[model samples]
Target: MKKTILVTGASSGIGRATAKLFQSKGWNVIATMRTPEKETEFTELANVLVTKLDVLDLDTIDSALAQGIDKFGKIDVVLNNAGYGLMGTFESAKRESIIRQFGVNVQGLFDVTQKTLPHFRQNKEGMFINISSVGGRMTFPLMPLYHSTKWAVEGFSESLRWEMAQIGVKVKVIEPGGVATDFGGRSLDLQHNQEFAEYNEFVNAFMKAMAQSMNPETMTKPEQIAEVIFEAATDNSDKLRYRAGADCEQLLGARDKMSDEEFFAMQKQILGL
Candidate 1:
């Protein structure tokens, strides 16, 4: 029998691309999004079930899982790709924004993994391909909220791998450096504070440097990330991390090899901050 994969946040970007790629490979795809009604293309595809799954809602998660299993018999992998970044200085972040960040990126991911663990344990073989970023292993200024969530993801995946190992379940993390996705437009939240005008120059410098650095010439595409996800699913390795974008390993390597001050100096020099 062909394998099956369930992908979250499949309305666009990496998740959508992954769903398409897996289906083309003859795998049953459970392509889920918060608003499945907003999607049009996946509905017409055979062996693909476009379902509604809001990560924050456990009920939706359960429903989607049940629906997928009922339709496809069994799911071999679960790709946690539904998340958004909250950007800006921590002090500028609203109470609700801060809560929402952890709620979705951290707690939301935790809930999904927790719900899937029992199923995977029962199967004695499964995989979790988490869509984290290179930012998960590194950090930048004016992005405490965003970085915090990614850092949590990295740590969570690392620790969880040990537990999953006992049951033949595998955990893999995709760390992309700079991807030209809707993340910068729709998946980003900008936190600001008029009271903190003193920090405006810093934020402006950071944004300017970021925009100049993560251009199309250097960034990865959705298809590229999809390819990496496919490899992780079929690589058949006990490996835990898969670096996806051009700068993913390079940027993360600096953090691993250099001291905090040295890494910060290099990053500042590159950004001209």
Candidate 2:
């Protein structure tokens, strides 16, 4: 029987690319997003179900899972790709943005995993592929909130692997570095307060450095990351982490080779601090 994969945040970017890639590979895809009605791309695709699933909304999570299982009979894999970055200084961040960043990136992921565990447990086998970032393992200036949540995801996924393994459920994390996605555009929430003008110069320098480093021409493509996800899904290995980009490999490799102080110094030098 053909396997089924459910992907959250399927309206765009990595989520959309992964959903389409799986579908093209003959897997049934439950492509979920907050507003399914506005999605026009996956409507006509065979074995692809575009449905509503807001990670923060438990009702939607349950409904989407039910809808997928009802149609495809079983869901063999779930890609938790619904998250965004909260950029800017933490001091300038509103309480709402802080809460929301954790809500969607960390709590929402927990909710989805908790809800899906039963199904996977019952099946005696399943896989969960979470979309983290190079930010998860390292950090840069002005994105503490985004980095914190991703770090949480990394720790959670790593720890969950042991427990999930007992139930025959596999847990994997994909750490992509600067993918060419709207993550820096529509998917990013910039927090700034006029009162915190002292941070203005620092933020400006950081942004300029980021712009140079995150050139679209150099960044990994979402489709490329999707291929990595697919490999993790089908590789049938006990590997817990898959680095998806050359940048990821380089940055994470450097991180592994350096001490904490060295890494911090390198990051500071990169931002011209």
Candidate 3:
């Protein structure tokens, strides 16, 4: 039987890239997004099933899972790639924005994972390839909220991996650093306020440094991430964590080697604070 994969937030970037790559590899692709109608490219493909799946909406989440199974008969892996980064200063962020950050990044991811549990439990064999960030293992200025969500994902997926071992289900996390995706552009939510002009110098410096991190020469590509996701999906190894690109390994290496105070001091020095 051919393997099948379900990908959320497949409109563009890592999700879109993964769907295309998996389809090329002959895996059935469930390319889901918030607006299925807006997707014009994937519909023409024979094996691609473009559907609506907003993470915040439980109805759509369950419906998409059912729809994928109805078409493919079985789902081997679920790529929970439907999240955006909530960037900028947390202090200046509106309460609503802060809540929505957790809403999409943390709560939405949790909801999707929970919804997939029943189907995975029934199948007796399945995998959840969650897309986390290297930020989960480290920190960055002006991205406290974003880092918090990723840290939550890292913890959640790690614990889930342990618990799922009892069953046949497998959980793996992909930690990518500064991938050159729309994640740094349209998908990023920034907080700003004229009322808090004092932090502008630090904020601007941080944004500049963050932008440099996403330069094509320094960052990982979405297609490269697709390869890691594929390996996590098919490698069948019991390994629970996979680092994508050299930047992820290096930065996370620093975090792993440094003490708490040392890491903070190193980060402050790098940011020129």
Whole-model lDDT, model 3 = 0.89
lDDT of each: 0.89, 0.94, 0.89
Sorted by lDDT, highest first, which candidate order results?
A: 2, 1, 3
Question: What is the per-residue lDDT of model 3 for residues 52-83, given as tens digits with 9 covering 90 to 100?
Answer: 99998999999999999999999989999888
lDDT of 2: 0.94
How many clashes in candidate 2? 0
In candidate 1, which residue pairs clash?
none
Each prediction's RMSD over C-alphas, in Å, is 1.2, 0.9, 1.3
- Looking at model 2, the pairs that clash are none
TM-score of each: 0.97, 0.98, 0.96
* CA error at residue 23 for candidate 2, angstroms: 0.6
Q: List the residue pairs that clash in candidate 3.
A: none
lDDT at position 48, candidate 2: 93
Candidate 2, residue 42: how far the Cα is off, in Å = 0.5
Candidate 2's residue-wise lDDT over 72-142, tens digit each? 99999999999999998888898988999999999999999999999999999999999999999999888
Better of 1 and 2 by TM-score: 2
